[model samples]
Target: MPNTSRRTSKRDLTLVAVLVVAAIGLITYLVVSPPGGDDGAAQQPAGPSGPSASQSEGSAGADESPLSGLARRDEGDPTALGPVDAPVTMVMYSDYRCPFCAKFSRDIEPELIDRYVDSGQLRIEWRDFPIFGEQSEMAARAGRAAAEQGRFWEYNRAIYEDSPERGHPDLTREVLLDYAHEVGMPDMETFTADLDDPSLDEPVREDLRQGSSIGVSSTPTFVINGEPILGAQPLDTFVEVIEGAAGQQ
Candidate 1:
């Protein structure tokens, strides 16, 4: 395992506590609120590293709809895959520039898709939670633009597959356009236009806001069926969570 910094360790602890508290708060809200109430609220393709199972062991239970407002169950959502009513929904908050997010995309996501999404067991939703500063924000916008053209996933994979294993790289307009072209976005003019359009930026910003509200301070944070799972944990961890959630449904 890579040596964790004190800051990271502290953040992990805080995240776990936040998740537990959020879980408890959710339970209270559900128990008291009226029924049928209306609620308001990746990456490349890096290699696997060490275990992150120890990072988040929160009390967040999958049995409750803790993330119902954020699950984006709309059948027409372009950034989501699998059936809208899939038994389990995996909401991934990630940055385009985060290497760990890339690793998760490259190493583990494909298997999850094959085993869960393709089989009508899971739906994966992408949230643009860029936190690495300007370039990160730009990348998020570019991703949203691609998503406008129905090429979000492909553009995201291109970004990660082209990324280095460490450090932040400059994701200038030239490079982002290159990625868009590489993804075979049929209408380059529309794609570029969308990237330049300010209106295309709101979903990414909303994602960041929603993620922050749930205490996500890092890229690649995931909430699977309302159960918080941190980092690019081993595939087995995902298997356990997905199967458990699916079984419950």
Candidate 2:
């Protein structure tokens, strides 16, 4: 009977090992070759690593993986949603000009906020990983300007919700200001002045460098509790990953 029990335990251990290996392999494949090809999100060539976002922020432990350290749970972060200490932290790297990003913002983000963020189970930190062009950088700066007025998320929703469904909308300076006005930004003067502020450029640059260092080659890339979910996947995929991360905690 003891021999039988030992054999059963060994079999269980072997099964668990195989499952872990398979999961790792799948994640690696997804990272190396993102799904949905070109129509999914704005892509960029992976560049050499710069100063890691975690190292500069001093938010990660020596033992923690770079992916896990991506979450900046700064309570004062105006662009962030949910409690700083939530069990699951999802660090999102996105470009404002990406159509796929607009889709995620329009469809999936609201539901995520309602289900996980409102319930205090998840924290989402936004990173501006603009890869489109000059307009993309401008939009990212505009987002920072909105954050100064405590209306970052409002501005975010306005930009994405108003975006065209088929392709990237031309995010001109006038258009960005229009969105700001649409979101009822109280001091348009201050918002306008803040848009081209050189200081705002650093944060955007930092986020871009951070994303590049982490092998984020596309917009709408998400790092949920150390696991990467590239592109705007289905709602069920997000739910499953979020739940799995929550259960592990």
**Winning model by TM-score:** 2
Residues 96-115, candidate 1, lDDT per residue (tens digit)? Answer: 88777888889999999999
Compared with the true structure, all predictions reach lDDT values of: 0.74, 0.78
State in Å the error of residue 71, model 1: 1.0
In model 2, state the lDDT of residue 12. 51
- Model 1, C-alpha of 202: deviation from truth (Å): 0.7
lDDT of 2 by residue, 94-184 (tens): 8898777898999999999999999999999899988778999999999999999999999998899877765567999999999999999
Work out candidate 1's RMSD over C-alphas.
10.0
**TM-score (C-alpha, index-matched) for candidate 2:** 0.76
Q: Which stretches of candidate 2 lie over 4 Å from their true place?
A: 1-65
* Ten-residue region with minimum lDDT total, candidate 1: 42-51
